[model samples]
Every structure is written in C-alpha cells, then in structure tokens.
Target: MKFHPYNLSRERLLDFYKNLLWPRLIEEKMLLLLRQGKISKWFSGIGQEAISVGATMALQQDEWIMPLHRNLGVFTCRNMPLNKLFKQWQGDLDGYTKGRERSFHFGSKEHHICGMISHLGPQLSVADGVALAYKLRKEQKVSLAFTGEGGTSEGEFHEALNVAAVWDLPVIFLVENNGYGLSTPVSEQYRCQQLSDRGKGYGMEAVTIDGNNVLEVYHIIKGIREYCIREQKPYLVECMTFRMRGHEEASGTRYVPKELMEEWAKKDPITNYEEWLVKEGILGNEEITTTRNELKQKIEKELAPNSARLGETYAPVAEEPTSAQSSLDEVYCKEATSTSETAHHGTPSLKVEGTSVRFIDAISSGLRQSLRKHPNLILMGQDIAEYGGVFKITEGFVTEFGKERVRNTPICESAIIGTALGLSLEGFKSMVEMQFADFVTMGFNQIVNNLAKIYYRWGQNADVVIRMPTGAGVGAGPFHSQSNEAWFVHTSGLKVVYPSTPYDAKGLLNAAFNDPNPILYFEHKALYRSITGPVPEEYYTVEIGKANQVQTGVDISIITYGSGVHWAIAYAAEHLDISLDILDLRTLLPIDYEAIRYSVKKTGKVLVLHEDSLTGGIGGEVVAWIAEHCFEWLDAPVMRCASLDTPIPFNTELEQTFLAKARLNDYVQKLIDY
Candidate 1:
C-alpha cells in the first residue's frame, strides 16, 4: 500500500513537507561549504531526513528528545532559528555553546532537546532520566532518544533499556538502522534479524517500520508515545533506512555495494512522498516545486557566511591561551549571592545542640535532613532502598521517602550516572551512590565525558552528587579498597570532596547537595564505623572548597585529608616534642590553596599526606603547588607520605603494611629534621 501523511490537515501536511525539505536543503548547503573549505566537517542527513522529521513531529513541545549527529531535522522541527544554528556550525561566539564545540554536539534547553555526545549510547540513559522525572512528577510527558544501529553494541544501550523497563519509565528508544555504522555493516554489528528484536530481551515491546515512509514513521511514533504515557512503560522502535551519502564529508562511500545504493535511491523518501501527495491530488507538481524552491532559498539566505569573525578563517593556534580564554572560569557556578542561598552556607543560621554519632550515622542524618528540605531529592544505587545499602547508611530512608525517591537501580553504572544528568536537566537534585569506589570505572565515561563536561561545553549545571565509599582497612581486596580520588581530581570540571570526621561528612554531604556543580563525595569505608565525632542535630553545610584547620603548631605542617587526617592526628598525639600543624583538605579539586599557603608559611616545613598511592596521588599536586608558590618559605623539601604504588592486598598484615600510616612517622620526622 502507498503511504500518506497520516491524514494530517492541509496546512499541517505542508508544514511537515517543509520540515523534511529544510534539512535536505541545509545538508546540501553544508556539503557545498565543506567543499569550499568554510566548514571543517558535515554529517550528511541527506536520505534519512524523514526519520528525524517524522519522529520529531510526533512528540509534543514540552516532551524531550535526544538527537544524534545526523538528526538535523530535530533542530529545525523544534523551530530553532536557522541563523543561530548556522552560526554554531561556523564556530561563532553567538552560538549556543559559545564555539566551545562544533557541529551538532550542542543541545538547546529552551527547545526541550538534549544532544548526544560522541559516545552515542550514554544519551539513551540520559533520556531515561528525563522520563524518570516525568514519572515522578506525574507530568504525563515521555522522552525519546535516537541512536544508530551501531550504537546498540554499547553497554549503555542494554543498561538504559533494562533500567527503563524495570522501572516502567515513560521513554521511547528509537534506533535508526541506517544500514551502516561508519563502514561496519548491520550483519557484523549484531546477529539479530532486526535491532528492535533485542528490545524483547529487555522486557519491553518492540517494532520495526519502513523508515523511508514518513507517514508510517509518524503514525507509529505518535501511537507509541501515547501508549508510553498512558502505561508508563518503555518501547523500542527501529526504523529500517539507508544513508545516501558517506558517514561524513571526508569518508567516501566506496565500501557500500553499488546495487544497494541503486535500490534505495528508487525508494527515496522525498521523491516518493511528493509522488503520493500529487497522485492523491493533495498538491500539484507546481506547488511542490514552489515549496522546494522556497526552502532552498531560505537555506541559502540563513546559512550565508556573512561574518568575517566566523567561518572566514579558523583562529590561529596558540601554544598557551590567556586566562580569559580558559574554560575553567566559566565551568563552575559562581558562589550563590542571594541572601537565601548564602544563608545555607558556612554554619547553620539556627544553632542546634550536638550529638555524638558514628560517621555512617552522620551521613544518614544529613541525607535525611536534606530530603526533608528538598522534597524532590532522589537517592539511587544498587541495594540502597529496601536493602538499606551495604553499610546501612540509608537503612530507614525508603520508609521515610517512598520507593519513587529512594530508587534501587540495576548494576548499570553508566545509565544511572547519565540519568542523574538527565534529572539535573529538569532542575531536580539527585545523588548516585557507587556500591564501592572501585566500581566507578564502570561508569567512567558518563562521569568524565558527560557530567564533568556538560557545564563547560553547553552552560548546563549537572546538579548531581556521586557518593563513593572508598579507602582500605578491612580485608576486602584490591577491588573494593582502591583510593581512586585522584582520577576525578585530575578531571577539570568535577568537585571532589573527601571528609574524614563525622562532622565534616554530614556537613560536606549537605554542602555538595546544595552546590550546583557535579560533586564526587568520597566517604572512606574504613572510617564509616571506626570514626565518631559530634555532629549537629539540625541542618548545616560546611563550605566545599575550604579546609578545616584541625590543629595549629609552628614546627612542621602536615597537609592531609580523609584517612590521612586520622593517621596524622594519631602521630601528632604520640610526638609532643615536634609541634605539628595539621590541615584537612576537605575538597580536592578546588584545593584549599589559601589555607595551604597559610599553614606552609607558618611552619616553614611541609609534608603532603594521602591514602592514595604515591606515584600519581593528589599529594603530588599539593607538593607541586607548594614548591611553585611557597618555595621561599620552606625549611625543607616538600615530601609526600602515601601508600606504596600497589593494589591493597587482602591479608590483614599486608594491608597494614600497605597503608600510609605505617610510614607516616618516618616521613614527618624527616621533613621536621630537614
């Protein structure tokens, strides 16, 4: 049977034609510019425009859509201004990402769109987060994400699908099977007869459609969207289509068989749709010609390279950029200046009596208080809800907040982290607890590439806190006892906070939630039960980037944080002759430089201490900074006391030997004598 426009109104049908035609014309213009050496690259959506146009038109304005690299129709269908999009492609400062990115790597919050990163499957999980918010808020909105057939191989694809299916989230996962993933064919990409068939394994309904038929694509998507909102369940839709051009302008199409191209060319979406419209007397050939001409003219006018500052020539490469050009300044939110926000920082405005508590209990108290303050706060992790977490930090949380807020996610780290980003996009706060700090490797891409880079790339705040239960003392081998704080500290955009005492744990936990940036809250597992201190019963937040000066002395300065703080204190108590000034660096990323400078200047000799291995630990960064800035104040060379460069052994005796505390006395005394 021949396809139709789903019986759309005459005006609506004409608008749909424009949506399909505009992207085709724009793609053509982009190719010309690429040949003329204006733009560096182009991902052609030449033949597969209907998938983007049809799928986008089926969704409402308030609903969110995650688009892929070739889905230019998503931007145009949402009514994003052509000039701004063209400026973005030309690397203009007026573009959405301020020329920080190129091509379609940018997303527009105003348009209710989230664009994909180079790693295609992470956005699928991010879309799940958006749908999760809709489910929680009862918004009756569904989120849709687009991916290529090749992207289905990513672990995030399976993770996102299973999480959505298990939770019955209102989301649609659309895989546009454009025949080829780069040069790899569908046969090699996956063994399934079709991409949608894999959805059944995820316990979700699945379907395949004639993607070249715009009306069929629209009809299926619209119905599926309604079904998802009503039932609050996920669905998988695969559109079988073909790309007419190479993957990009530079990649030639020599690998594609000639016969396949000829067959798909005859079934071209635009040409076939135009014939159907004319055959049914929906419009005459003259009208179709007139519309095509108008769209072409509009593309030319909007995409004209009028600015000498943009696209005329690329900027000259600089060996070193000035401070003004550094992205570090703009990536993090400036200190909140409003009276209400400022009041939440430092000490609590209302003084409350203190109670002695275990470090784990203190964390629970802070999280419980924050949940009460922010009713929409969400807590997610494996076995965190009904199971009360492995450490029982959230033992009674599920009873206080329902299952909706206290979510127990699958063993899908990438999806959960990406979902946290999605929650942040909709102005909700979320915290993801890694079962152990070592498992962060499973979600490393989503954390560093997506969460850490979001604010720097597109001016979006990822208001999510990742709780890491770290450090070693128990006989839990190398897997569970890694001190992995340095990995995130080296990453530019994430805020790293490791608190030693119960007071700082509760206070830093509160502050990390209140702050807008993505924060990694590292809780040393060894200190969870072993450490105890007085924590305020009432709500309070310790400043994130400030260090706590535990004690003051003049002989030698010991800078440390987390488990090292406890070790330093024990050593100081034993040695009264050598006066020790101890500084606990609560935050690692935005290291407390001022506090370090003051303590180093006072004592004249310094030792950087941390639980991480000595080779590339945060101690190196501290030592390097002290050498650069406080060289004149030093009485001795700056030294670092850390665990040996080896995995934490499981044996109790070996573990004790592996810890920095075993060698702490020698390192501190050597620095004092120097």
Candidate 2:
C-alpha cells in the first residue's frame, strides 16, 4: 500500500480523513458553544482543514511546525489530546498556557509545535532558526511555518525567505492563500498574480497547489519535504483555498459577495472527497457515514460533562491559584548568584586585581570563553562571521568556531532576533549583537512580545543575551549614540546589565550567558577603547542586580552606571576637598535598591547621573526611589545630573555641552556643600 515516494498506505488515507473530520466537527461544536455563551470566540477552519492535515501529515513527528490560528488539524494530526485542547480553547487552568492565552496561541513543546502571536510574521523567521539548527547539526529534518496570503506582505516574510534561501536551510514556507485576510479581498491584499511568485523573488523554488485536494497537497508536500532535506534548500508552497466562514465567529462575512460564497460552496472539500472515495471504490457510503459518526461521538465524549448530555452546557473544572503572590514571583527566575546584602558603608568594594584590558577586549575575552565552554552557543549579527563584527569582537571566531556557530545575518534586525528566540526554543543559546544600539528598534517587537514574554506566556525559556553598544560621546550623532538602557529596564521579563569597567564587563557578560532568562547586556561604545581596568584571563562571573562601590566617601553619593562612573571618578580626582560615594549600578531592571539605600543613608545626599537625556531616564527611577525610601535621610533635595533633554549632537563642542559630565562638577559641589 505504498504511495510511490513514501509509505502512504490505505490506512493512512483513512487517517487523513479522520484528521480532516475532527476539526470540522470541533469547529461546529465550538460555534455551538459560542452561541450558548460558553466560549468567548472561535476562529473556524471549516473548509481549510485539508491543508493543515495534508501539510502536518507530511512532516515527521520530530520536525518542528509553526502553526497559524486556523490550523486545528495540525494539532490533531500531531496527536495532541482532544481534552487538553478543549480546555485550552475554554481558557481553563488545565490548558497548555495555564489559561495565559486562548485558542491556538499556545505552543506545545512536546508536540513540536510553536504557536502564533497576534502579530503574524515573527513566527516565520523563527522557523528559519529551527531549520538553521537542523542544518547546523546536519540533521535530515525540515521546518515548516504556516502563514496566510496577507502575511506575505510583512517584512519578516521577505526576510525569512531570503535568510533561509541564503543559508540553504531545509525549510518550507507554506502560505494558505484563503482568498481574503479578514474581509480584505485578495485583490486588495496584493497586486501579484500569485503569492508563490514572491518566493521566487527570494531565489527559492515556488509552487501553487489546489488546497481543497487533500491527496494532492499531501503528495506534493511529502515530496517537497524530501527534496528540502536532500538538497538542504528552502521551498515555498502557496495553497490556493477559500475561507468557508468569517475570520472569526464574531466577525460576520458581510463583505464577501454571495456569488463567490456560492461558487466556493459547490467545491466543499469534505463532500467532494467523500464522493471521490466512493466513486474510486475505496469506500462505500455506509463507511463514510460510519466514519463521520465515530468522529462526532469522539468529539462528544471529550466535550461532555461527567454525567450531562452530549451537547449540554459543559462547565470546565476550576483550578484556583496556589498562592496570591505566585504570579508576581514567577516574573523573574530565582537566581543562584547573590548580590550585596549590605553595601560597603564608606569603603570601595571593587577589588581591582589581574591584568589590565580595554573594555572591548574584556567583552571579546568573555565571549571567546563562553563559546569555548558551550558548543551550542551561537553568535548572530550583521558582519559577525569572517568580517568579525563592527567592533572586531568576533575577529577570529569564524576561523575558530566556523560559520555554523558564528552566523552573519542580513540587516533584518527583527528576523535575527526572532531567529535567536527560535534557536533558544530548540535548546540552543544565542548572543545577538546590535551593530549599534539604535538599530534595536527594528527588533523591538520580538524582544518585548516574543522573547521577553515567551517564558511568562507559556513557560518557555529564551536563553538569549542581546549585546547593545550604546551611550553618547564619540560624536556618533543622534542614532548611534544613545543610553537606551531605560527602554528594556521598563520591560518586565528582561534583565538589564550595564557595566562600566573591563573587569565588570567580562564578569557580567559571563553571568548573563549563565542565566536562563532573556538579558540585555549594554556596552557603552565610548568606553570600549578609552577605559582600561584589571580583568582576569580566567573565566569568571559577576552577580547581576548588584551595585559596586568604585570610590568611597562620606559627604555625597554619586549613583550612576556606564559613562557616569568614569565621570564620577575623574571629578573625585580633581575635587579633593569634597568626598563622593561613587556607586555603579551594574544592573538596571533589578536596580540594586539595597546598595542605593545604603549609600544614600551613609552620605545623606544623592545625585543620580547618566549619559541618557534628563526627562525620561533611569535617573528618574533612581531619584524616585530615593525620594520614597530615603527621604528622611536626605540632607537636601534629591537632584539628577543627566544629558540635556535632546538628541546627541554630531558637533563635538555641542555634544560635550549636552553631556551630563560637563555639569557633574556643579551638581556634585551643590550636593557636597549642602
């Protein structure tokens, strides 16, 4: 019963029917429940079941699949339990995401399925990463991602296709062109003849197939999957289909013309397939009825209450929270490394031992150490391979680790970051370097929505360290020079680390690599060549969420990080009469409040300093905390010394005037004299 290329027996044909029927029945039941006010909404895949069924059935169980919202057949074909899926759609605690998300928004690691987000295109690039993993490991596995016709318009779609093609990774970009994208007709969506043609633009082989013909889709994709693995190249398959129902049950299809609906209805996949089965002598009418009846019964059994009727109101089992504080507690992972319990009251805690190295070299040394320690560690960014990196941080990495470990990505920031998350999903650690910190805005959605929220949404850890070369000073202008640490510090699931010295830089980088959560490691570009300090040749780690006392004094506290630390040290050297307690905040998100409090209490005067602009900076957060907690100990009003509220100027003189360091003497004098 072999089907030529692969073992698609007669029994497998029957199983495909079952897979198609299951979603059709489930959609009917969900719509009924919606009418009864039991479920909130439903994204029905009434007629598009064949595409998912055929595509999923073609892939191996271990091969990863990134499914869209309409791919219920993908889950069923992968053998996800019907009961748990029902609970997930019902938003019950027993769901895969623990009711954090509803519908097809939850990824199941066990099923090898990565779920979709509201923003549709990121998952496509993530699939490229999964495929890249297979390529890197030389595994004969292909990664598949589902997207609609409208998704092709997304920049990520273009980036994913080009990346996969360039890398010669085994991946299938499946586009389900369902005539319309939520009321916008195909005519309005794109001017191209076929969505598959866009794939050719990326230099990949593309094809269009009849989505309604389940047998055709299954056969084509099965062959394509084999070709991808054999050639280690990407393929784009565009399935032409029509949405038999509205985008969601709530959004009615009033915009769809009656003539078009009537035309598509005559080509119903189930009815047509049943006729083909009967006419070809594969099965009788009775067998078709029997198969449909069994599918209906199975759905009924799964959805029914303990003793209630089949279609009766089935209330989900309620599960209460373990504790009221559990939600807040899980936001950050509990760390093994401990920070300072009590600050060095009036003494500098920094040891300053070992050979002196520049800040950039320390970073390079730490990265080299990490790469040597972990074989799965990947460094991804623009110009990071043979060209090293923008800062030569990975100069000899390609020769040492090869191109598989040191990947040079396209200028698609969003895609590279999403790829990092995908690599993490498949048990690989990644370090993504932004050529300049400003370019991070391109990948902001992936960082905030995907990486930062993945662990919180579905308990999937994103072991990634995004290296940001930031801060103003070399007159790099508005875009290149920016102390943008505050942007990620405001985000919840991310750890922000900013180090000032070579020793701290090397140690903190290693610490960030060791952590399981997503971390933002900010390296000030200005300090790269200028600052030199003692750095150990051996691998070591500095505890995150800790502050270091660089210089100890009793009169005033200069609380800062990055360039501010150097400014404080220089000011202290010149102004010998005034005593300054220079405290460098190594991490921003978990802002070493204990160290700040101890220093403020000891000095009785506080001056928050940073290279970022004054109005909405981390300095404001520090000043607010001081005002709230250490108001009674304050000798004068808590003041902030920060860059003027404007973009970093390109002119050297103007830049110097705009920087907070120019005003540090006046601010420190005022605090010390008070």
Candidate 3:
C-alpha cells in the first residue's frame, strides 16, 4: 500500500535491473538473427525497456498483462523462457505458437498474458474486459494494457477508454509514447501536445511520465496499480520514450533526423537504469557486467540448436486436444440419452406442452434463463441496458439483472467483440449483441484473426457468443439489412447458427452459451416478430451442427435456413403436387453433411436457397458439397437460388426483385421437373 520507491528492498531492486537486462539482450540477439536471415522480422524495444519492465514489475503476478508488439520486456519479466522465445522467432514447432504465428505474437494463459495481434489498438478493450471480470467476481486484481502513441490514434482506443471509465473497471491503460508510429512522428499522428490528456476527457485518472527513468516509471505504475484496485476505476499512464532503433530491423531510420536519434540515445533506458543501480550501491559495476555476460551466454545457449534450422522448412506442430474439445460430446449433447436431464446448469426438464412465442421473445427468454442460471454469463451491446437494445429483445433486462450484468456499451463493434475475448479468457461467458449483422464488418479483424484463431492457435477456449440480427426486411436499407451468416461460415474456427423457428432460437442459444467455443448466432430480423412457434418454457438445448426435416417428401430436397426456411415451406404448401423435402439447416459451419447426404440421396434432386448474395454464399458451399458427396444419387444438376450481388434496396418492389424468395418457387419447380 506504501507508494514510496525508497521502501523497496535491495534484492527487489536488483531483480528489476535483471528484468531490464534480459529483454535488452534478447532484442540485440534477435536483431543479429534478422541480419543473418534466421528470422523474418524483429520489433525492438531497445530504448523503451524501462516502461515495459517497470510496469510489469509493479503488478501482482495474478493480474493480467496485454502487451503490444514492442513489449519484449514484458514477456521476459513474466519469465517466459528464452528458448521458447528464440524458437518462436525461428518459427520452430517447439515454440509457444507451435510455428503458427510469427515473431512476438504469442500468449500464455498460465502467465496471465494476452498475446497481441498485428492490430495494436483492440487489446485495450480486451484488457478492460478482463478487468471487468475481476470487478464482477469482486477480486482485487487489476489488468494492465500496453500500446504505443500511434495506437492512440485508432478509434478503438477512444472506445476502450470510454467504456472502462463508464464502468469504472480496474484497468491500467499504459501508452508508451515512443515518438514514432513506425516512421510517422507524433506531430503528424495527433494535434494534442500530450497523449495522456485524452484520457482525462473520458473521466479517467491520467498522468505523463519520463519513460527513460525506470525508478520513476516503476513507482508511478505501482501507485497507479494500487489506485485502480482500491478505487475500482481505470487509469491512463503515458510514458514518453523513444524507439532508438527502427520499427523493425529492415525499417531504416532514414526518415528520422540524426540529431534527434542521438539526443534520445543518450537517455537509453538500460544504461540509465544500470548506472542508477550502480550509483545507488544496489549493484557494483563488476556485477552489472557479470549479469550482462550471463544473459548473453543464456541467449547463445538457447539459440544454438535452432540457428542452423532457422530458415529450414518444417511441418507445424499439431495442437494437443484441449478440455473444450475433449468435452465437446457433453457440450453438444451428442451422446446424451435425455435432453432435459443433460441441459446446461442442470435446469429443470422441459414440458412437452409448448407455448407459442415470437422468435425475439424466445431468444430473450433463453438469454434470461442462462443469465439466471450462470453467474458468469454477461450480456453487452449498444443501448442494451436502459433502452433494451434497438430491437427490444432485451427489454427490461437492465432493470431485472442490473446494469453490471446487462451492460450498455459505446457504438463500437470492434471493442464489443474484442473485449468479449478478454472476458472469455478470464472464465466468463459473454453474449455480445451486434445492433445489426451488417455492422459485423467493423469487428471482422477481432472475429477472423483473434476470436476465430485463439482456440486453434493456443488451445484456449473463447467461450463467447455474438448475437447477430440479420437479413433484409423492414426497409432498413443496406447498412442494417444483411444476411451475413455466410461470411462467418467461411471463417474456420467460428460456429455459425441461423435458426428460423422460435423453438430453434431458444434451444440453439441455450446450446451456444454452454458450448466452449466462439459461436455467431444469426437471428433473422425479419422473423423476430413475424415467426411464432411452440417453445418449451423449461430450458433445453438443440444440438448444434444438425439439420431438421421440417417436411418430408420423396421428389426433391429444399435446403435452407433462417428466413429462407419460411419461403421454402410456403412453396411446398402451395404446390402439394410436388412432394418437397424441406431441410432447415440450423447451423452453418460444421454443416450437417450426414443429413444433406441422406436427403439428397433419397430425393435425387436438390435446391439450395438463402438470402445472402449469390456469389460466395452458403448456397455455393452446399451445392459444391452435394456435387462431391451426393453426385451419384443426383437425377439432375443441383439448382441454386440467392439474392442478387448488390445492396438491398429501400424500395419494396426493388427489394422483392433483389431477394432470393421471389424466385424460390421457380427454382424449386425447375429442380423437381428436372
């Protein structure tokens, strides 16, 4: 609780000095490797070691740290092995990422570190999410997030700070103002004189410090960490430093003036800290030399074995099955004998007497039940708290569950999903509602690059569900009306769920919350109030990755999902002459291949329909699969129908002409006649 630096013991001071030495030596070694063509890239934090090491040392070991690309000191301070770091740099199979990622892109759940991606700004929101989890659990731990001055220019930076301030999350947003964002200087990046000043506008405690002084940075962050934990509020610390070297080894300093570089080099963090240690009598000059020599020896020993094989091609190491994957059978209820007994959270058995509920109400009821059952389940979206979301799916949720559980967020798609990743990492299940599915593109990087790959890359389960309100209807225009389930289906690690009926909406959401992976739950906006069906009041789960036979016929199979299912069923009901088989695909990714094969084989004809655009839609994937697997059974070439490859029009007539449903009857008749 004491904030004075003089109270620190000599042994602890020496340890901080050692933390500085290791990353400095490792960065030099990595640069050497880059020159030798052993490594592809190197982002050095040579002059910026004090900020990373001092801030990391100030936190409790249980607290989380989300480091940017330049924070090699944070990794070393966390005691990540030098051998693993070297192997990762060389892209070896034995590395932390198992050769899947390149330099400095790795995280360890055991170490309480969130690995960073190339996009630098999103991690701030993720760290805030982790801090939010701690606050929710009433833990005293804090989360530290690092980014450079250049990253502060991004929109996510503002969104993250605002959310953390509004929620009073226990997070430390550390901005290492290293003078340059790649080659662009601070003058061009922002008009503000001080980067930390921006944090004050968000109602957070903000400070600026000299990063070259390790003791100053260490003392300030130590106080900041305690302040965050004690007050349960966020703080922003901007440490002004310089990048002595280029962004990477290949990025030259030709753009920077020699005089400025020389001026900053004089205040090198490692040298300044080492001299301070020696002057303070904590370490002698001889001891400093000996420590540096020992670190050099350790680096040489770690890199020796991988030196020769650095550029050699090697197969990527296979990830061992994690608890999430091993427990998939139980989560998905694949082998469960009783659905009611095996439901998540041990909820009561569902009664067969069903009540007719609208699609949106079913989704809300399922979410409410999950929230009541699971203490760790959190619901977040823009205008979701008081306004009950734009669609009123979460109406009265804030009043029922309180704002802490049912939270409102800024209009930031990236932060909503990115922060959910942090919550998932901290053992909380977060359900994020996108105002509309069309806006998902704003968070595409977090979805495709981060959330989708987190589990596959490190065997860490991102147990988060993103609720996507989709499809073109109600004249919401192009921005609001889009059936983008196919975009997520194209991504590998994500599970795509597009349920039509109310029963399927409630059941699938229950299943999605329990599944230990990222799920994109696509609910058709058109069907939110329009569709109603029998839904059990008791909690239950519909198996993901399975198709339901809505109506059985022998002539042809009509494959569809979401709003498309209604069109297919209507066509079948009107024309009783053609015995149509309607197969509604509840889940898109991990498609129901067995069901498709069986239906196509029995009918010997197929018509795949969806509301997505014609090119690169789920229809193409379905048609391709049928051609490959059910080709022999096909009596005719597979027919396909989808919306035109253009933006949804506001005009009702133009919208009808552009939609796939307008031509579904014609396509089904052709498939049957063929």
In terms of TM-score, the best-performing candidate is 1
**Residue by residue across 410-432, what tens digits does model 3's lDDT show?**
88788878889999889898999
The CA lDDT of each predicted structure is 0.87, 0.86, 0.84
lDDT (Cα, tens digit) per residue for candidate 2, span 1-674? 11222456667767777777888988887788788867777898888888999999889999999999999999999999787887787777778877778799879888999999889999998898899888888899999999999998898898889888888989999999999999898899899899898877888999999888788889999989999999999999999888988999888889999999998887777777767667667768899889889888998787764223224454554478555477667776564334222223234675667899899999999999988877889999999999989899999999999988998988889988888888887888899999999999999999988888887777788888999999888989999998888899889899999999898898889888878789999999999999998887888888788888887788899999999999999988998988888999988978889889889988899899998999889999999999999999999999999999998899999999999989988987787667
Q: Which candidate leads in lDDT?
A: 1
| Model 1: per-residue Cα lDDT at residue 463 | 87
Overall local distance difference test of candidate 1: 0.87
Q: What lDDT does candidate 2 reach at residue 583?
A: 93
Candidates in order, TM-scores: namely 0.96, 0.95, 0.92
Task: Locate the minimum summed-lDDT window of 10 residues in model 2.
Answer: 337-346
Residues 1-674, candidate 1, lDDT per residue (tens digit)?
27865668878777777788888888887787778777778898888888999999999987899999999999999999888887778776677887778789978899998887999999999999999999999998999999999999999999999999999999999999988999999889999898888988999999999988888888899999999999999999999899999998789799999999999998888888878777878879899889888888887677564545335554422224446647668878664412222122111123325888999999999899889988768999999999999999999888989899999999999899999999988988999999999999999999999998888788888989999999999889999999999999989889999998888898888888888889999999989889988887888777778887888889999999999998888988999888899988889989889889989988999999898999999999999999999999998999999998999999989999998989998988788667
**Residue pairs with backbone overlap in model 3:** none
Worst 10 residues of 1 by lDDT: 339-348
By TM-score, the better pick of 1 and 3 is 1
RMSD of 2: 3.0
